[model samples]
Target: MTGAAAAIAALVDRRLTVAVAESLTGGLLVAELIGVPGASAAVLGGVVAYNTELKATVLGVDAYLLAEHGPVHPEVARQMADRVRSVLAVGGVPADIGLSTTGVAGPDPQGGQQPGVVFIGIAFGSTVTALRLDLSGDRQAIRTGVVSESLARLNEMLNEMLTGA
Candidate 1:
């Protein structure tokens, strides 16, 4: 199954919801979920932290970390995922999952990292993990891959967390 369909089904079946924080993929990751029907039953909301400052200011990525390692680092992705889960919460109601996308997708590299070097972060229950993806493509393709990989990571998490498979 597609990651969007799998995520929505698993999330809905388990009475859970998800939020996102994005950088390189922009809003594409969340947009994929929203495109699937009944996504509202599982998707809470998302944030696009496209700028370096916004990574810290908007999504709560540590300012020191951004300065020390820049926005494309795994820690940035992890923080984006871990913190966005709290940011989307309202009145003590928090989403059950968080996902993040951060990377370099460009004609020129950022933070000394090559193009298509991405880290997808996921925070589910008591666990938070980051997936490093070194891809080969133009800008759009890299971003597209990030979105697909992000959802697939979430799909894997759903399987492990819910289906034990």
Candidate 2:
């Protein structure tokens, strides 16, 4: 099983559910997790807000923040993470964790940020943090790298949270 799959398994054992929000990584983040068998029980849902404006409309990111810093900002990632968890909440299946990816992975820079600049926001329990990554590659490579790193970090975060470390 993939790292994301194993992480989902562990989360399920802990009775925790997860939701994802994506922009630069698109839907790949969720796709990676759901590919693992039994992930459906722990993986709540995901949203792909690739459009700069849709991040606010669909994920409830602050509109003024979008206009001020665009979609690539760290706070944007944080809000997307938190909002997706809330949006995907069901009566007994509330998402306990949120993961978000937002950045520029392209042949050109965006919002004055370099092309491979990425932010990964993860909310585990009551703590939420955005991690900045400066990747190196073409569009596809950067996106793939983001997926790999985000899932790895998520797995680590889940372990830390579960172990109370």
Candidate 3:
């Protein structure tokens, strides 16, 4: 099993639900999570906000915030996670953790942000944090790297939660 699947399985075993909001990686993060057996138990759902409008409209991201900070900013990632959590909670999935990835994964950079520059946000309860990763690769490779690293970070956070370390 992939590391993401395994980490998700661990979360499920602990009865923790997870939701993802993806931008550059699209639905690839959800695909990796649901690729595992019994992912339905832990994975609440996901939002693929490929467009800025949808990110603001459907995910409830603030337009002023997006316009002020742009989509690739860390605050955008944090808002994405918070919005996903709120959505999942209303849906009764009630996710305990939310993960979001936003970035430019492309042959040419957009939004004045460099390609392979990713912001991954993690939210647990009222606490939200973002990690920035500057990866080196082609489009697909960068996306793959983001997915892998996001899962690793999730695992680390899970370990911290479980071990209180």
Among the numbered candidates, top TM-score falls to: 1
lDDT of 2 by residue, 38-149 (tens): 8888998899999988898889999999999998889998988888898889885558999999999989999999999999999866778899999998999999999999
Off by over 4 Å in 3: 90-93
Which residue pairs show collisions in model 2?
Answer: none
C-alpha RMSD of each candidate structure in angstroms: 1.0, 1.3, 1.3
Question: Candidates' TM-scores?
Answer: 0.96, 0.95, 0.95
For candidate 2, the lDDT comes to 0.90
Runs in model 1 deviating more than 4 A are: none
Off by over 4 Å in 2: none
lDDT per prediction? 0.90, 0.90, 0.88
Q: Give a tens-digit lDDT track for model 1, residues 1-165.
A: 788998899999989999999998889999999999999998988999999999888888899999999998988888899999999996778788889999999979999999999999998877888889999899999999898888888887888877666
Between candidates 1 and 2, the one scoring higher on TM-score is 1
